[model samples]
Target chain A: MAESVSEVRAWVNQRRGEGRTIGLVPTMGFLHDGHLSLVKRAKAAGHAVVMSIFVNPLQFGPGEDYDRYPRDIARDRKLAERTGVDLLFTPSVEEMYPRALQVTLRVGDLANRLCGLSRPGHFDGVATVVAKLFHIVEPDEAFFGEKDYQQLRIIQTMVEDLNLPVKVIGCPTVREADGLAMSSRNRYLSPEERRRAAVLSRALFDAARRCREGTTRAAELVQSVTQQLSSAGLEVEYVSAVREEDLGQVDQIDQPCRLLAAVRVGETRLIDNVALEAGKGMGHVSAYVDR
Target chain B: MAESVSEVRAWVNQRRGEGRTIGLVPTMGFLHDGHLSLVKRAKAAGHAVVMSIFVNPLQFGPGEDYDRYPRDIARDRKLAERTGVDLLFTPSVEEMYPRALQVTLRVGDLANRLCGLSRPGHFDGVATVVAKLFHIVEPDEAFFGEKDYQQLRIIQTMVEDLNLPVKVIGCPTVREADGLAMSSRNRYLSPEERRRAAVLSRALFDAARRCREGTTRAAELVQSVTQQLSSAGLEVEYVSAVREEDLGQVDQIDQPCRLLAAVRVGETRLIDNVALEAGKGMGHVSAYVDR
Candidate 1:
């Protein structure tokens, strides 16, 4: 049986009491291959798997696409079961937020940068709801995709700072053959916008090519990508090259760096990033090359 | 055997899987008879009790006694054992907040009244920590005292609005013989200040008495208490009678009302309230009566 939040929690507790491990994969439903990849990873890591299907309202701003966020519990349930997920907690909005919330978690400087600047309270909402879900799910290890790099960082920080016993595992971002990052929001893009959106990844790749060819000034690389994205008829939100681990802006890319950008294709906002290393063409990269 | 947070969580999960009930009583580590009463109640309600002893730093304002908050872990552990608590989670600060928090939960208008007014971010800290604790503990039922009436109300609102699965059980306030409300902070009062502080309760009773005796003017009742507290060598912060539930400031005592006041006795801040019925003398006197 696909268990409710309470039932799954009870079962998880029992298994945990007997010294069993449990894993969690949080998704906004409309589970696709990317979500399944996380579920498969959780199941492989040993333990029962739980998938939470909640389109958290806290993470959405007013006038943002919260109301239009895709949700298909029936389909998500079928996908989760196929992927060996032991439990599915598909709670109603009323079930998640029964009253007004007075307490919130703030992460300080990190949140004020990147996607947070544009989304405003976006990361806070993500952090708060994830914290709540962490409590409800109580998994041994929670899986997230590095595709939403900032979000992944924020969750990692929240879990670590809060001393939550769950280990946060970052999974590689799954992408399409055309190199477009897979997101439920991708559905919002018109057919022309969808084809044009691949320019984001191409721009990131072009930036990575420049970095590999010994181009170090982050500002110059970001400017190049901005022009390319603008030329491609996209409204560029931000184009920056930051340190891969901390997500902090860098003036000169001396080590492995992340080339990230957000742009609006038609009316839909799309974000993407790629890791780059000086003198390495994606393959022969060494970890901590800066030191 | 004693358990860590993970171990305890696992145990709780197992018992829950077996269809047993679990309850949580969240408290800072100075376990007194009052906390024990709550534990006893949880046990009597057929719950396997989990007591969380964390002196949350976020809930304390800068220079508002966060450092001076009392703690005795050894004593608390003994008390938990005596109270038959199945698990006790005493996480370190580093464990509780491993990274900076970015999101905060706010209850809007409710948090702006009473103790909230005096200690600005206090309830936000309380609500956040409690919410974090709620997620970590994942209890079927959580116990809170009506002594901190505003806090109880705010927490109830947060739980209800957030759609958290736990049932919030509001327990009655435990009091001292002289009618002073029992609080962990009460220990901070000097022998002289302790005696003088009882005036807070006395003034509340006085206001309730005047209201019951047909004194419908809330301003007059507030003035009397302010004068009485000042004469008692205490600095009165604010004294107001308002609707018990909504906490809206009202002039006439025509409905359920709360006589609330916050005073600084020497350096220690104390808060107290008494419910007043329109024509009855503090009718159906309950220690922590809601409107």
Candidate 2:
């Protein structure tokens, strides 16, 4: 485990000297299955896996969860080591940003959609910190979970736009047996809210299944998912269907699109998404749901 | 000259394999002594020097000189080879930005003063393209002239803020025989304007001399420089003395500071700057002015 930028940089330099390819998996801590899956994927793809555990303050809003964001270095370190992560970087916030970062990175209209609607500047913060991580690690490829679909898309676009030398690989979202997508914020849920959150994933899978059954209208799919969350007493923020490639709007889904939703179950906000092609049901739905 | 990004990237990779350190000199064509000096400095410091000649469209304003920006590729190629540049990258704008670039990078307040004040969104465009060049070239050190002092500071700050791997080197401003700073836009000047523009460099030097003679007030230096430009039949835009490092306002010049001025000699906008320590009268004034 490296706690300083210079230390991790020296380690990376040494690894690069040995001609080893590196993969980066960036996350806020608390060791969820989703983050671990990214680490496992990185290890499989690149010779060296470096997992960075940082609760980037830049990504959080004023009233957001920056202060209470879950963190457990001991648990995260163990999980990373078990998953064959070669380096675990946990730099302090001060170390990451000795002075305030004045440079702003925005992805235009792409960042103004989906999760970006309610969480303004969220993706910009994510993009900035992710860039910093990529530069520091100098990885050949970076791994991200499809659970945050919009985030995954924004990162992919940023890499392409800036011609960053890192390939962005989106791993499938890891989930729980009870049909709830794994998230560090899942720890904030009470027992009742935890059970209710299962509806979030179930709704997405059901919507994807419907799309496979020829309900190709994006509006119809969005309405179906929104109704399910509402029926389960969840406050639906947005249930959007956007073209999977660039997150562009999709009126009639002729190709692959994504069904994404953010809802409030009691006090915790939960998000889940699944890709829908006309003939393809949820690609890995069976892993999350009994059906 | 390597005309494609892939070609230059391949050449860079080959050099890295041989343990050669690379330096990058970015420029807009129309080879001048200013740009050649940067190439020479890069070759001296690093094992290999790569020069990129691209008139970046992103940095130009709507009514700016982008369309009329000078270009002489044949001459530029000869000069680059003559200076012993290891690689010359001259990628077309299309190759650099295949799609409309959506990622926007800005250097905040640092970009809102001086040239930035006159040219809104200009530095943002510069920061974005410079970042692209750095990523594509991956040079150990990148060179720029201090004639664009604000731009140099902004790039240096952006690099530190983003943890970019390249070291930014600021070389002294190259000057013409009669004390006119070398700029690609100098070709636009008429004979009279060309002769009169030497006043810009002269004013900066005179102000520096005054500071060294114990006139250490920033306001006094600014007034003296502005007076010199106004008397020379030139349109003075701004004359400011700021702390050399951050371009912060310097009320009392107890430490090193910079005197920057921008003006219009007929139709061409020319800018010049000089550094002033309490007793250092324009460290390189002997080269630019008749002392």
Candidate 3:
């Protein structure tokens, strides 16, 4: 495990000197099964896997959890090593951003939808830090969880636009046994809220199933998901059926799309999405909790 | 000379296969001696030099002469080949931006002062295009003229912040025998305005001399330069003494500073700057005009 940029560079250079391809998996710590799964996929690609655990303050908005983002270095280090990670990089805020950061990398309208609609400047922060990491790590391939569906899309677009050499691979979202998406923030939920939090993913899965069964109207699908979360004692922030490519909201499902929802169960915000294929029986939805 | 990205990449890979270091010099065409001088520096670095001539629309605001920007592919190709350039990449706007540019790389306060204050979003465009070039070229070193001092500083800061592997080397500003700074825009000047354009460099020279001779007050130095240009039949846009690193306008010349000035000679806009060391002598002034 290395905590400094110079040390990581030395390590990466030594590997590159031997012509070994490198892979990177960037995470905000509190290592979940989802992150470990990305590490496994990265390793499977004949890459020397490097995982970075940085709870980037740049990605958090004001009044958001910049200060209190969950971090446990000891626990994270153990899990990362157990997952066969070749190197674990845990950099402090000062290490990553030595000075006040003024430079920004931003995506266009893609950043103005779904989660971005509420958490303004969130994707910009994600794009900037990931860009910095991509340069510093110089990995041949980078793995990201499709759990952050919007983030994955933004990163893909950025790499293509900038002509960055690294390939971006998105692994499927890792979920819990109760059909809840695995997230670090799940730890913030109370026992009661944790049980209710599963409703977010349940709603996405159910809506995706409906879309696959010819529920093509965007308004009807959104309203149904919104009502489902509300009935489950969650406050729905947005229920969107957005095109997979540009993230533009689709009026009718004529092509592949994503059914995404963000809900607040108590003070903890949770988001989940499932891909929807046009017409009956083609889409794959995660297991749904029966009422 | 390669006009496409894939061809350039293949060439770059061939060179890297032999373990030769690569250098890049990016320009908007109509090659001048200033650009050739950078090629010499790049060659001197023992690098296989690659030059890109792209008149990026992203950098030009509406009505900002993007259409009129000078370009001569035949002449430029000849000049570049004569200078030992291994590859010349002249990508069309469509090749460079296949889609509408929805991603931007921005350097904040550093970009908002001096030239940026007059030309909003200009530096952002420069930053974005350069970033894309850096990734595509993957050069070991990139050469830039100090003639665009603020731009050079912005690129340096962006490289540092983004952890880009390439070294950004700023060569001293190249000038003509008449003391006018070398620029593609200089061709826009009429013969009389061309003669007057030298005043921009002269004022910067005089201001730098004054600073070296214990003229510490920024206002006094700016006033002297502004008056000099005004008397020389040039429309003074801004005369500023700024810190060399951050591009911050300094109220007093207690530190190493840059004396920057912009002027309009008829319809042509020209800018020039000189580094000021706070002591006697040892500064190179472009030309005295000897009127």
Candidate 4:
């Protein structure tokens, strides 16, 4: 386990000396099936896998669950080893941020929509930390779960726009038996809320089913999904279809777009999405399993 | 000459295959003696040097010199080959910015000072371009002339803050026989403005002399330099002494700091600075030469 920036860098440097390619999986700890799936993908790619578990404070709002964010070093270490991770880095907040950050990254208009609308400065925080990790880990490829679809696209866009020296790979979103997208925050849900959380995925699947059947207007899908989540007794933050790249609102699912939603089930806030495309590049997007 | 992104990336990959360390020197074309000096330093460091020449449009303000900024590609080609640069990349605006950039960088408090004050968004442009260049070229070490001291420091801070994977080297500011710092914009100065431009450096040297003789107060140094530039028929934009790292205003030269000044000589605006330290880290900061 690498605990400092220099330690992980030195480890990567040594591996690079041995002619080994590296794949990175960045997460906020309390590793679940979703994160491990990414690790499996990285290992399957014939590259040494590195996983980082730093709950970056910069990405969390003051009112958010930064303080209560899940962490389990022992379990994480065991799981990482079991999953074939070559290196597991868990740098402290102090180690990652030695001082107040004077230089940071801010996303453009793409941030003004979706989750960025309510959780302001959130994506900027995510971009800044991800950029820092790319620098520190110096991995050839990095993996992200598509459950956070907007975040995955944001990271991909940042990499392209900034020409960051890493290939961002999006893994299929992992879901529970009931269709709730697997998340660390699912631990915050009560038994009843956990059952209700399945509605989020149901809504996404409904939209996907509708889009596949030729009803591709984004507004219609969003309105139907919003009704489903609201009727499930969840506080719907947003339900919309946005461009896969910039999250720009689209009138119809002309290209690959994501149907994203955020809802509060009891006190636990959860978000999920599934990719939809009526035109092209729909093969790898999340599919609603007929459970 | 590498004119496209893929071409440059392929060239760099081949170079990397041979285990050759790369040095990058980014410029806005119209190569001058100052740029050659940076190239010379890169060659001396024994790395295969790659210099990029692109006048970034995003960095310019409404009335600023984006369109009129100097360009002579044929002359630049001759100069790069003459100076031992292995690869010269001159990507076009369309190539560097194929799409309207949705993801870009913004420097924090450090950018709100000095040149950043009057020319707002200038360092952000510099930071963004440099970051892109760093990604595009994958250089081992990048050279920057200390003539743009604030810019050099911002790049360094960005590199450190974000843990960017390149060494940012600061070459001593190359100056003329009359003590005026070398700049590409010096081409814009008329014969009359050219002579008066010498006062900018003189004010720097005077402040250095005063600091050496125990007058290390920043306010006192700024006032003296302002008086000298104002009396020399130049419009003073600002004269400041700031910390070497963040460009934070320093009350006294207790640590390594920089005395920065900008003045308009006739229709041309030129800026200059010399480094000072009453305590430590003074060895490499810019020193005023005895003309």
Instruction: Please list all clashing residue pairs in model 3, or write none if there are none.
Output: none
Query: Candidate 1 on A125-191: residue-level lDDT in tens?
Result: 8877787777667778999987788898878866655546579998877777777888888998889
Q: Which ten residues in a row have the lowest lDDT in candidate 1 chain A?
A: A282-291
Q: How do these models rank on lDDT, best leading?
A: 3, 4, 2, 1
From the highest TM-score down, the ranking of the candidates is 2, 3, 4, 1
lDDT tens digits by residue: candidate 2, A96-170: 999887786877888888888889999989999999998899999999988888998889989888878899998
Candidate 4 residue spans exceeding 4 A from truth: A277-285, A288-291, B277-291
Instruction: Report lDDT (CA) for all predictions.
Output: 0.79, 0.87, 0.88, 0.88
lDDT of 2: 0.87
Model 3's alpha-carbon lDDT is 0.88
A best-first ranking of the candidates according to their DockQ comes to 2, 4, 3, 1
Instruction: Pull out the clashing pairs in model 2.
Output: none
Question: Model 2, residue B147: what's the lDDT?
Answer: 80
What DockQ results do all the predictions give, each relative to the true complex? Answer: 0.29, 0.82, 0.76, 0.78
Cα shift from native, residue A22, model 4 (Å): 0.7
- Specify the highest-DockQ model's number: 2
Tell me the lDDT of model 1 at B233.
96
The interface RMSD values of the models, given in order, are 3.7, 1.0, 1.0, 1.0
Per-candidate TM-score against the hidden true structure = 0.80, 0.97, 0.97, 0.96
